[model samples]
Target: MNRKELFEKKPRIKINDKVSYCPTSAAMELIGGKWKSVILTHLIEDKKRYNELRKEIPGITERTLSLQLKQLETDGLVIRKVFTKKPPLKVEYSLTDFGQTLTPILTSIIEWGLRAAETKGEFLLDE
Candidate 1:
């Protein structure tokens, strides 16, 4: 790429008080984590209850899930809703408009995973 193109492609910017020379770093700050992206992948489909998220993500522990959810919420990427006013409370999680912006990135990641599983790695069945 030419110097002018490089300059156009990567302009320094700041978000959430962090300065990033490259935009990818900014994106990673918000979504780069072991479980953050996975949780987001599920949320891309639709809103899910807390238990539902826990169930869908097999290896994630309850505490970890809770923590990740809180972080995502704090980052303005996820929203939580409580429906029930009494016992057997109902809560659901969904992507915010900002979170929805990640749909394409997440989709690309999903596609890459599938391709790698087929071409380079093997998918194993759960015991």
Candidate 2:
């Protein structure tokens, strides 16, 4: 369908108290922030401690990472596990079953990013 017709006929869907005209947009809203998908991509391999995530995601501040993780957990996409009941607490973050469903999608984004960098720009890992 043409762009105008598509937007005109499709009814909006609502979930989690957010209204969205497109499902993709709604999906984006959930994983829309700068670090959410990156965080998810990292967690795809295995659960990680909060500090491990901080080290892997360069440039992300402690506040932002913590906020993103909390949001993800609230959305039922991530689980936070605490293994200690006292000082020197140990915590780990892992994806929920629903979050695992995002594997292909996140992988596709990662692959596309590589393709874009190689074709249009360049990889600066050595620099």
Candidate 3:
């Protein structure tokens, strides 16, 4: 089927009552996009500028990265700082304290992914 038809055919989840979005769902809504996790992972290190992030994450479009960064900022997971300088100005991104709380969770996921990759021989295929 064509893209539109395929999407139209898919079933959508709906809540019958006036239920509010749960914390878990809200969290997912913030970070569940394609680039948020990678962005957060990079921010776990030292603060980085926009260009630095683009270089590190291959295949991400500038527009997508910008949108993800904005979302993270809105969620209070990332702080964006702009410097007023002559010649060339710079923008930097860093994790807020709320965002830092995600470090252990992301680290655990990374560790589990590493173990799973080893067991499944996934790394060998990448070589």
Candidate 4:
């Protein structure tokens, strides 16, 4: 679909009463972004520093990573902690209880994607 058609297709929300867009759809409006899932996947392990996450996920630009991290923090899925230390200092990120709940969901998505790729003989590209 073209840009105009896509924009016109998006569900709109109403404020007070009347016929309004679905709330669940609006929630996905925030969470349904590309890098959100990948950032959450990395945090599923353990608390990681900004640099550590960058190293783990290859090919992600620093700017994009920063944006994703900020968004996740805003959504309350990830908590950012800053520590006072020596020269470089430190910042760490860990999943909140809310974020931990998404692990199984992400695992399922990964499994489904793998199966889909395998059936299409495109799984090799993932490796």
**Top-TM-score candidate index:** 2
In terms of lDDT, the poorest run of 10 residues in model 4 is 14-23
Cα lDDT computed for each candidate against the true fold: 0.93, 0.94, 0.83, 0.81
Off by over 4 Å in 2: 1-9
Model 4 segments beyond 4 Å from truth?
1-20, 125-127
lDDT of 2 by residue, 1-127 (tens): 7878877898786767889999788898889978999999999999999999999999999999999999999999999999888889899999999999999999999999999998999877765
- RMSD for all candidates, in order, please: 3.3, 3.9, 10.3, 8.2
Candidate order by lDDT, highest to lowest? 2, 1, 3, 4
The digit string of per-residue lDDT tens for model 1 on 24-86 reads 888888898899999999999999999999889999999999999999999999999998888
Top candidate, metric lDDT: 2
Candidate 3 local lDDT, 1-127, one digit each (tens): 6868745665343332323245455456667867898899999978999999999999999999998999899889999999987648989999999999999988887899899998976775554
Alpha carbon deviation, residue 1, candidate 2 (Å): 21
TM-scores for the candidates? 0.85, 0.88, 0.76, 0.74
Error of 3 at 12 (Å): 19
Clashing pairs in 4: none
**What's model 2's TM-score?**
0.88
